[model samples]
Target: MTKLWQQRLQRQQRLMLRYLRLVFNEFFMIAVFILLGGAAYSYAGYIKTLTAPLWWSRPLVLILLLVLLTVGHFATLLQAADSLFLLPQESALKGYLKQAFSHSVPLPWVLLSFVCGFLVPFLEIGGGRSLISIGVLWLSVLILKLGQLWGQVVQLYLPTTQFRSQQVTFYGLSLLSLGLGLYSWPALGFVFSILTASISRWRLQQVQQQHLFQWQLALNQEASRMLQIYRFFNLFTDVPQLQGQIKRRRYLQPLLRWTTGRTTNPFLYLNWRGFLRGTEYSGLYLRLLVIGAIVLLFLQQVWLALVIALVFSYLIGFQLLPFYRSYWDYPQQRLYPQPASRRQQAFLKFLTPLFVGIWLVFSLAAYQLWLAPFGWVIILGVGVFNVAFLKLYVPNWLKRHEN
Candidate 1:
């Protein structure tokens, strides 16, 4: 079981590394750097503008810290096959789970440290805490995270009835500990965190003694967690492991009818159907669109808003390009009466409205931020980029990769 855990971890790591390389390609890396640079610059400017902790600073920081504490889960790495294959070894599963939880700890801890470092200024300058107190506060949250992880470990062996109660206890402890840490003495929070972690450890031991491993529950949780990771990766590149759910968005049938002209072009009709019904393409489109719109809405600067709009617009079209050949593997598609050129033509036609719709949403956000002239500029600028991407970049890309 131990070796099995190690092998699984290594395989998962290698797969993630492979996707990470593709996800962070040259252009995407440049975009990420630009985004980080802009964010840092904006953060510094906003921090400088703060005279005192605004009225909402304490509660806001507390809520954010609480949220951070709630994030992350115990990764068992147990698979469906494990339920049967490893049944004999179930008694030793505690050791394997311990290893899994330990492995999961470092990433979230590193993330927590970075976030705390980022919020340090706000804690000190805004909430009027001493540097040492802020350090104590971080330590407190760190301990609370351990408790949270232990609680998750306990959850795996619990029945649903017990699980709900455990969840209530977990949240209650988290809230009180962090609230004390932020509002009262930092040491009080630290003390409560230690107690919380200790209690959670006791709870895990108790649960292990009283209950058997819940195989179905454990496997289901692992699958759900992995699916989320795959969904994020799916945004950057196709993830075969990610199984998208098909949604019958009946209300969207009208839009499909108008776009495909009732199967005038079978390829176009198929693309439209897949985009609307399959979660993969439509989910990606909506995620980018909403995220881009939110970012643009928040940004007061015209240049920043324009950059965001153009970046998002390009991303949507670029990602959707894969849909052009989505049906090629179907041997029946090769026998379509339509010429090969029509596929490309239909793809562009399918993408045209998508691009236009995304641009319009972004333009509206920019308009709300800075009205009239700037909004018109954003609209025109994004429209031109969309046209250039479709006319210049996409064709060359498809041609270069042509079968």
Candidate 2:
């Protein structure tokens, strides 16, 4: 079982490395650096402004900790065939699960600590804690997270109702533990966390003894988990593992009428309809647009807001570029009367208005950030960017990946 798990883990890591290289390519890394630098600067400036604790500071901190508690899930790495092929070895699979649990902890622990470290300012300003006390609080939360992960693994063996009931109890204990840590004594929280983790360990042993392995449930969970990962990668590039869902979106149907005229290209109709009905392109566009708008609304610096807006607009455009060839798998599409060049023209026609709408929405959100002449300059810059991206970058891209 250990060797089997090692083989699976190595394969998964290789697959992940391939996708990670694609997802974190040059442009994305640069964007991440700029975004992180800007965010850190803004965070520091905001922290300086909080001279005193606000009324909601404690509650907000508690809520953040509560949310953080639920950040990690179990990874079983079990396959569909495992249910049949490994049934004879099921008794020994406990060791495999133990190894899986061990493998999962490091990531969540690092993430928990990283986020908790950022909350130090809030702890000091809001609750007036010393360094030592804050250290204790971090340890307490880390232990609670371990307990949570243990509970997750243990629940895999139990019935649904029992699992849910255990979850509620665990949540209640975590809430009380964190609340006490933040509000009362950090040491008290630490004590409660140790007890919680120990209890979960005990429950895990009980389940392993009493219950049978729930192979189908575990396989479904792993599938769902991998799907989530593939969905994120789908935003950057094509992920064969990820399948997009199509929706009717009846209200959006009226917007497609513009594609009906005799002068319209047939490809335009397909593009518009596909984008409106499918979750892939449409959902990605809306999520980026909404996130960009929110970021622009909050950002006080005009230049920073403009940079962020342009970055998001570029991302939306770049991601949607892949959708241009979305119909290539359909043999019928190849028989269309339109010339090859006309297809490119049709794509440009579809993209032009979309970029314009994005520009308009972003400009409106950043209106407050605009200074007299700089606003016009920013607008022109975005316009020029759209032109360069569509005319220069896109054609080069198509040449490189000629369908």
Error of 2 at 186 (Å): 1.0
In candidate 1, how many Å is residue 3 off? 1.2
Tens-place lDDT per residue, model 1, 307-344, is 87777777777788888778777676667556767777
lDDT per model, in order?
A: 0.82, 0.82
Off by over 4 Å in 2: 333-337, 371-377
- For all candidates, what are the clash counts? 0, 0
Question: How big is the positional error of residue 209 in model 1, measured in Å on the Cα after superposition?
Answer: 1.5
Stretches of model 1 off by over 4 angstroms after superposition: 262-264, 329-336, 368-377
Q: Please give each candidate's TM-score.
A: 0.93, 0.93
